[model samples]
Target: MLVTPVDNSEIVAALDAALDGGPAVLPLSADDPRAGELRVAMAPDEPTLPGTAVVVATSGSTGAPKGVELSAAALTASATATHARLGGQGQWLLTLPAHHIAGVQVIVRSLLAGTPPVLRGGQTFATAVASMTGPRRYTSLVPTQLLRLLDDPVGLEALCSLDAVLLGGAATPAPLLDGARAAGVRVSTTYGMSETAGGCVYDGKPLDGVRARLADGVIELSGPVLASGYRRDPGGTAAAFVDGWFRTTDLGLLAADGTLSVLGRADFMINTGGVKVAPAAVEAVLVAQPGVAEVCVVDLPDEEWGQLVAAAVVPVDPARPPSVAALRAAVRARLGGPATPKLVRFTDALPLQGPGKVNRKGVKDMLRGT
Candidate 1:
């Protein structure tokens, strides 16, 4: 389903065809260079699972993209479990691009509820939220979207009108969540990826029939909602799935109360002078600082320390960027000296790879002026 230009009618049609057990629909981003590469990699006559529904391409920030083949049963299980957990099915407002799993799940859930989602393309979020009319309204968004919505009074009010707002796609800073909840936004922090068919865990608790376990600090998910495997990549599928559990690159801890706390991505860990630091931890602290709108932390090549902690910051006021010393002090107070950014570069905006995720690699290149 070549998802481009954000066409609601085309997305709905493709999703309907997939739900009916047609050829596995592979949704591609219009701007992604890898879209063409992925097309060539996939066999024209490749055979998928009998009920294969959708094949979502993983964001290839770390490496080559892999297509996650989700079956109709998996999609149904995900939608059913989500609705059951959210109290009941309701109208969903689709603000995210349809190529990603989060956006696709909204459509699936809306279809299950026998209603079309309020398509919010080419319209301000405030306008879209105001147009929604339903008894139980819900929408999923990334932390960045929620942050932007909070900046507008009308958007904030419109957000509060919903029964629930799911925040996912990236790790949300604690301060942001606190602020949203304080503003009465009914925010639910979610943890899951495309492999688990969107967010299987809401507010740290696994949804119905979904199981969360930690294997040496790595998160492993298992349930009916799990995707079959990566299309046309047996090795990638085998590496990610073992013993009926999908091993995620994210490192997390499952609490005694069964809540999950994601620390950060294992692959994203930075080694600095024999110490390992999770960039997300430092980013969380920096984002909470005053005058800081966005931040991306990366590991820059260094001669003395193997790799040094560096940060690319987007200040709220470009004319007066946040104090570098103050930013470092915040991280030092919260995460110690090793995690503190050795180099801080202020930018107009953090480079973005996808809809709402910060492009760490791109930020690193930008910092180097490459």
Candidate 2:
């Protein structure tokens, strides 16, 4: 069954059907045009795993959206491991779109807890969170949402009230995490994607039964929580899932204390004048600058450097934008000269793709036009 509506009743029904092992459920965003395309791609006689419970779409950094076939076992394992990691299952406040795995996990976790998640829509985050009841409370949000909540006193108070908050969908800035901690918010930074049935890692440590390893510089994950494979995309599946490990494009470092520090995606590396620079590393530095609200670092094609480091910055105060020279100087001082953004553009806001992820490709395209 294909479900697109964001309504609570619709989502609950879909979840129930999937858990009962009836028809597999495909949750699509109400506003996503790719939903139709994915349906067409699935066709009339698409083969799927017998135990498939949910097919989540992942378009990644580029290309057509591919349906990731997650089995009942995988979903249950994820939920169980999450609860174990979080101490116990609790009431979840559903704030994210249900189509995404993180959002779906909230409902699955709630179901496992023998309670219904408090549905939230159109209400201010503070009010919605304040309305939640039950002894143990939890919610998941992206960095964007966390940033907004931090700006609101009531929202920050509501956030602090929760037992735990799972922050994912994209890398959480260090400064943002530190600030959230300072506010007494129990923030757990998560790492994983649709293929892993949401986050399998909480705060850099793999959950129970989950194994994380570094193959060269790339991150590979293995365990019971992995998806069956990409639906009807064998070639894609083989490339990503190999030898019982899901090979992620992200590059990471395994610390001595067994913590994982994600550098960035290997594909996103900017090779300029013989030096390879991780955009994420540069972005972290840029985001720490005063008056910078958000930033996206991309590589602009250049004849001399192969690709020049460029940044699109959203200033906290549009009228008082930070100087390009000062920003470059900061980056150079912290990282190096090559890592400094050679081309800096100011924008009102950075373009977002899915669930608050900065559209790096889109930013690069915009810079190309300029």
Q: Which prediction has the highest lDDT against the true structure?
A: 2
Tens-place lDDT digits, model 2, residues 195-297: 9999998999999999999999899999999998988878988999988999988999999877888998898999999999999999999989988888889
Q: Candidate 1 lDDT, tens digit per residue, 248-312?
A: 88999888999998988998899999999998889999999999887889999999999999999
* TM-score for each candidate, following the candidate numbering: 0.94, 0.96
State in Å the error of residue 280, model 2.
0.9
- What's the lDDT of the predicted structure labeled candidate 2? 0.86
C-alpha lDDT of all candidate models, in order: 0.85, 0.86
**Least accurate 10 contiguous residues by lDDT in model 2:** 1-10
Best by TM-score: 2
* Model 2, residue pairs in steric clash: none
